[model samples]
Target chain A: MTIKILGTGCPKCKQTVDIVNKAVAKLGADIKVEKVEDIIKIMEYNVISTPVVVVDESVKIKGRVPTMSEITALIQAS
Target chain B: MFDWLIYFSDWLIYDVSGLSEGSRLGTALSFFVYDVIKILILLFLISFIMGIVNVYFPVEKLRNYLNSRKLYGLEYLFSAIFGAITPFCSCSSVPLFIGFVQGGIPLGVTFSFLITSPLVNEIALALFLGMFGWKVTLIYAITGILLGTFGGFILGKLDLKDWLTDWVKDIMAKTYEKGDTVTADSINFIKELPLISREAWHIVKGVLLYIIIGIGIGAAMHGYVPENFFEQYLGGGQWWTVPAAVIIAVPMYANAAAIVPVIQVLVVKGVPLGTAIAFMMSTVGLSLPEATLLKKVMTFKLISVFFLVVTVFIVASGYLFNLVL
Candidate 1:
């Protein structure tokens, strides 16, 4: 499974990265967490806000950082 | 409404601390205490209420609404109002700006949103109401809206589409694609309280330092500066001071929360209300970091034009306020 974090390098995006990594580590998941920072690439996702979490190609969250529990739940569900 | 707070501050400083009522230290500390408590309460209340409102009426819906409507130029007003309500961080502006442009919103309308989003917001509103009286707050809010409306209208007429950077132009030329929309979950106010509270607390924590430092400087000025110190230099009669204040403020970026308290003290020190407000607006509205971010989307010429137009309006409003108020 793959998780893509879309942002333009904002502080919140960095926080989102940290939280997602920790959540993945805790859950012992084999998910590949990738960061999408290019503006054009981010726009391709059609998101106006940053720090979006895309599980596979579907956007799970956008515009805010999700909690660890939320991330773990999302990973397990996906 | 805050008489109890005033009374409590007086008692704490004069009775409990045993400081003389009129002493400089006593006056400054009291001012600090009253202002800090009052502003914090107001901030939390406003943030909580606004958070609830934002959740119910998502900004994405508003953006789509603005894009789909042709409001006979009243869209500028609506866009400015939208800007005032949405609470995106400054760094996220570029993406939002591109989104608006891609969504077929007029350049001017988008400009209106960009101009007012940072300048007039709930936090600024609460700060203004807490520090200054409602009358000043009302006037300031109206002026900010008007500034965005007029500033955007003028920019829209400039036909500066080519002023956008090549990368933006390339993106604009591409066929627009609509992203998947997140459907709002059913209303559950009971479950939403925690989220609302977290948002409110987040806002308060974000500006806590600014509030302290701003009020700290204000308290010092209140205690030590002579009543006429600022007035003597930046008096209402000085035509140059208004423009000078705006110019000086353009490069120095500070949020409204930090600047408002200092502005209140400046007014108390006898600086013209108009001049002080102009400085506050310019400082909050125009900044080097925001400009650098915009470079990703707009050419240097367009950015300069945007700044010049806004600066002129701020200076004009400053003069108008001096004449009327």
Candidate 2:
């Protein structure tokens, strides 16, 4: 599984990344977490909001500063 | 007052002449070069400082404390002062605003902080004093504080307290956990300064256009704005001019440091310094974008009250300036 966090280096994006990391850890998932900070590439994923969580090529969440549990559930379910 | 005009006219011609000297292209190049240098330096300093504050300051604790009480009157005054210290811009300030409402801080008090936080501050005051003079800076500071205080107070009194968006309240209930106060482990202050300085430079570079636009507007106002318009319309002689100025300022967004040059021009051009200041304060403090951002968290009535209270204070300050200054 691949988890990607998209943002422009804002605190909220960072928080999302952190949450996703912990969630992946707890789930013991074979996931590679990637962070994308480039604005153009983020838009390519059809996301207009920063701090987006993308699983594989599909967007899981956009424009929110999500919590740890939320990220965990979303990741495990994915 | 009339005598001051002759002196101002003489000064204006002197500045314009200096700007116009040399081949037109050469002069324009030099002006752009100088502007770029200055803006780069200023922006770097401001953003770096803001970054340092973001990284180190106890912002969350203070924000939480401010929201913990419904001390509307004193909170307004506190919010004005506190807003100056917090480095949140129009965009970055929203999440904290969500934090404010979640902590049960009154809408009016939060608005006070929101109004003052963007419009006036130490960095801006320093720049104003450096570019203009202390007297103008003093007037700007006083007016800014008055706007925040009175705006908050009046908004608190409005009966539309329950007008916040349901999503805001719902979101607060779900994910409003506090961050750990582990700032001691963060980078040391001395080490952070250089990093902050660099970022501030970046910001200055990015927003140089805002400064130029502000000054360019001032230059035109100085050169134009018709000498008799102020006395005929917005001067101390007119009662409605104060509110009119406030209304005019709302739709526009003018950064406080950038607006000084224009305010100076408007003041010299026979626009009552008070009315001009009111216009400046209103635009800077209660900008349309800022209000729109608030809409994400607040309902329409609360937002309307936010605008109205700030406008009332700005108009009052305009009248006050005419009487005092």
RMSD of each: 2.1, 9.5
> How far does residue B218 in candidate 1 sit from its true spot (Å)?
1.0
lDDT tens readout by residue for model 1, B78-192: 8888777776577778888898888777899889988988888767878989988899888988888889999999999998899999988888888776646673658788877
Superposition error at B208 for model 2 (Å): 0.9
Model 2: per-residue Cα lDDT at residue B157: 72
Q: lDDT per residue, candidate 2, A43-66, as tens digits? A: 455433356788887777654555
* Residue B220, candidate 2: alpha-carbon lDDT: 51
What does candidate 2 score on TM?
0.67
Interface RMSD of 2: 10.5
Looking at model 2 chain B, report the run of 10 residues with the lowest lDDT sum. Answer: B1-10
Return the top candidate by DockQ: 1
Q: Best candidate per TM-score, number?
A: 1
TM-score of chain A of each: 0.97, 0.90
The per-prediction tally of clashing pairs is 0, 8
